[model samples]
Target: MGQLPTDVPWDVNWDKKFESQLEELKQSGSFDTYRKKTIRIIRNPIREGSYKSENLKGLKTAHVSGNYQDIICFELTPGVNHQSQQEKLEEVYLHFIDHWDNYDSALSSRNAAGRTVEFTIEMPYLEEGYDVERAKNTVYKAVKDLDGSRITQEWGDECLRLTGEVSPEDKDVVKTAIPTTVDVKFNENTLF
Candidate 1:
């Protein structure tokens, strides 16, 4: 699980591109609106919608702004050992900002590097004599072996829930790596 800080101030990394876009916004006639939106994002960036904020489909990146025309793109960096709730995760990297006219191209370029694929799999139903810890260990080991993957596990009423991200190209490998007996289901829309 990813943990977000409740009282701690989040650190923001202004990329070169974002910095320049911000300057342009500052000089524009709509500077006040853009500035307020940027401040709101810096103060609490995880909120989505209404302000044209959304998590980019199939990726760990997101964007938010006062209007559709001027958008700020950012990437989330989950903290180590944080509890698994996605909303609670901390750390944001502001990497890009551009007009709606150039949004698609900017998104495409960033995704070309690598897209994040999120998955949810249920642990297999264990027999009475089977060791639950060992079963979990197997799943954890499989995910750990992946090149770029992070997962959070939770025990539910009837099954164990595993959710996390991995490189798009490694999706198939991850599926095969899970224990054969485990019954898993992937969220189709989340697969890159």
Candidate 2:
């Protein structure tokens, strides 16, 4: 998926009529201050304006910076109806990339540094047995999306478990997406 207009940093496109006004600000040097303020807001929006005190979880905020004709604006609203868990998760993933440095999406209760996710799938319902290997790969992909690394994968029949100290994120997404993405009846063993 690509940017959905709801993504962060924002897009600012000034009107053609304002070219002269913009130039005037540049000539007067006041534009430099506005420009820096705009840039700062774009770079780390959550740490700016109203959001300076809060963190994120696919939740976004807005700001209208600068004055009169020189005004620049931004607003973000989550999708009208994220029909699928993946779509909701993809949105979260976008934010996940934005605040990767400042936030932790996955925090294991077992330890400060480790995250654990486990799932088991039973395929006896299918006349043709399901691919256990695909299930393994699915677990790996989910773990990777969680930012999991140095993982310890233990596979049994149709089950997979992961645990390690790799500072990952997206645990909330994992809860819904993993089971749905794998398209299997899943029994979640654990998640962090």
Candidate 3:
């Protein structure tokens, strides 16, 4: 299913509208700077702000720990409601694409050689019966359609990589089977 919005205006008041909400985000000392930077980057550029179920499941965080390095975190909240688990994940998948690089940089660092790098992308989920294969494909589609020019100057492409693995025990929610047939034998001659 297509989880994004339809007929969204490309030009809208993204900043003035969400300013108050963003200010409240600063309470989290860990996310203060990153959140501010994201606002500046997304306000004017991403004119259309819509939610997909992917956004719900798309809740993600990136962390980096090393000498002389402070950890940072980033999350994608599309603000969309998906009625079903699969739909929620799809919404999150789409939302994550909007800020992939921000998440990556927060979790990355430069080595002695001066090349920037991140250890890994950390994404956790609260839903059971989640589909890894489906999620991977969904993310792939999201990043491939990323809009670079619309984002703030601070963001980049590194966060687009879906490099995490699923825990082995993860399972898809069990669904009840539908009745396929009714047992019946007709004895026409014995109908006397």
| Candidate 2's TM-score | 0.23
lDDT tens per residue, model 3, 1-192: 111133222232234444454445545543645443443422212212332122111112121111112222122124322223224332111122224344433223211211111122222233244443454344344333322101111112332223321111211100011011211111111000
TM-score of each: 0.41, 0.23, 0.17
On lDDT, the candidate that comes out on top is 1
Model 1: worst 10 consecutive residues (lDDT sum): 59-68
Q: Write the per-residue lDDT of candidate 2 for residues 42-109, one digit (tens) a residue.
A: 22233233333222212222221110111122322233232232222222112211221211221111
Predictions: Cα RMSD each: 16.1, 17.2, 21.7
Decreasing lDDT order of the candidates: 1, 2, 3
Error (Å) of candidate 2 at residue 157 is 6.4
Model 2 accuracy (lDDT, Cα):
0.32
Give the backbone clash total of model 2. Answer: 0
Q: How close is candidate 3 to the true structure, as a TM-score?
A: 0.17
186: Cα error in model 2, Å? 14
Candidate 2: give the clashing pairs.
Answer: none
| Stronger candidate by lDDT (1 vs 3) | 1
Q: Residues 1-192, candidate 1, lDDT per residue (tens digit)?
A: 112234233443333454447546656757546534443333223333221223332222333211122233333443422223445544433334344334334333322123456677776455454456676776677777675467788988877778776666767766775666665555322211
Strongest candidate by TM-score: 1
